[model samples]
Target: MSSSPIATVKRELLVRHLEAWAPAALHRARRVIYAHGYADADGGVSAEAAMRVLAEQSDLVRGRELIMVATGDDLGAIDPRLKTISAESGAGAGLAVHTISGGTDGRLPVGLKAVGAQRVPVLGFLDASGSEPPAPATVAALTAGKPSEMLLVLPPGSSASSVDAYRAGWPLFTQVELADSEEPGELLVYATTAGKSLEGFKEALWSVDEFAGVRYRDPGDPERHLIDISLTPHPGPLRRELLAHLAQAGEATVTELRTFALTETVYRAADATRVLHTLVDAGTVTRRPSHGRLGGDVVISA
Candidate 1:
């Protein structure tokens, strides 16, 4: 099936995350559950891509159990494709794939239980279409404890309250807007309580290959700036955010600032240092112990 470039990018984002998160999660949780909403309808690209990763990198998944629960109205097309992928990849005996033919509302929860999700870590990719997103209860179920994470693709103009409701219990939550040419596109929401999982996601977000005529928008940015998905993305948004954070705190250590960037903002912790050094060079902000390299111990004031 032919997929639009932007749609393909979204799938790649999920695959890239699984590539990074699955290995670490297997080591930490002993088992992994991947629940896909709208699996067959979207051609099962993400599930297929993710399963291929497990197949190709057998060493990382040797002992750990990986269960993939794919939910869709019908699996007539995707089921065969998935079977072929598993067969060709020669995925290990430990890997299990379940195709639930029903609405995600009822079947997703059932699939989760059938796989012992409560006892293991789960990575749910709720690829919601149009205005309707996965229910708040569905999202809450995924955030039951640490190491369980959820990713949602919400339509444009989705309510802030809907997102807030989805983010309710998670200690860490972040979203990136997929731009559609000139206008803002769908929103990709990620919620989790695990710091390591969140860190892995952030790495995946910036590392995915750049798509033409598309850029990711920092939803937190007031101007709704569209930025490229690159290692050294423009730090304009971080610059403003740091100034506001410094204004409120009066002064903060480099470590504190870096943590703020990591936890509270879309920018990575490494971006914090680069923006700070630029600010200091411009004389917009001052750093104590300015005579030496910008270490974590150095303090910054606006």
Candidate 2:
């Protein structure tokens, strides 16, 4: 991919957008369940999102192991990109299209079935254009007791209640995120079982010159930060990177640090607080008084 500032920010947005979630959703994914209204030219937006996830995971996967399940009716007849992406020798995957019907609220998508049976980790990308968003029971049934996550794109002005219900049913995760994009007028909802990155997702797109001006939602919560960075190989340097941001900013909220990691640094929002706590632990930085062990603003030591 091109390293242009916008492209770079977008890619980081996509990755950290996901990185705040489960490990299975990215590096260790075994299957990808893609559901969309119909296959569009050039494989459609669903394919593009799935491709981004696969590309993000390419460096981690060895040999062809990941399996992709999509709708059969339209999928088999159009767009070969998914087929090509699945057939690669190393990081590519294998494709399976399940017979799926469209344009109804009650009709169940076959992709949901693929997600349920898998014992391996999964990344479910659902585009709710052809049909209404899956019911909460549906999402819960597919993700129950498994390390799984889903990214959904629904029609604009979608019912907050419906999205809420869809999120409420999932047993694995408690956070339900809603994001807006201008071009599509689409509502993007990301729900994961492990972590949160709403702040980071918003940060990746807004940029000025060399600075990708993405900010964190909350910087005071260290516990959440710990959960986010645990997925990465080295938490130490990532933490330092967060500290450096704090040093530059003088003193910032926990959410600000999370934002920095999501866009400015090659780290997740969780990484910001993890390093802040480390600095506080070492007596190198001072934190606001009485915000609990993991909560409070932080200042770089003089």
Query: What's the distance in Å from true for residue 287, model 2?
Result: 12
- Candidate 1, superposed: residue stretches over 4 Å from native: 57-63
The candidate 1 region of ten consecutive residues with least summed lDDT is: 53-62
Cα lDDT computed for each candidate against the true fold: 0.79, 0.46
lDDT per residue as tens, model 1, 130-152: 43677788777776434688888
**What's each prediction's TM-score?**
0.90, 0.49
Weakest 10 consecutive residues, lDDT, candidate 2? Answer: 174-183
lDDT of 2 by residue, 1-302 (tens): 23333333333444554444323444445454434333342244445455545544555555424444454235444446655544452353333433344422233334555445454455555555334555665455446424555555556456557666776644332221122222223444555454443343334323212324222212222322221112343565456556666667777767666656654443456656677777777877777762476653543342
* Candidate 2 residue pairs in backbone clash: 86-93, 203-214, 215-259, 216-255, 216-259, 218-254, 218-255, 219-254, 219-255, 220-254
For candidate 1, list the clashing residue pairs, or say none. none
Name the lDDT value of residue 98 in candidate 1: 82
State the TM-score for model 1: 0.90
User: Highest lDDT among the candidates is held by which one?
Assistant: 1
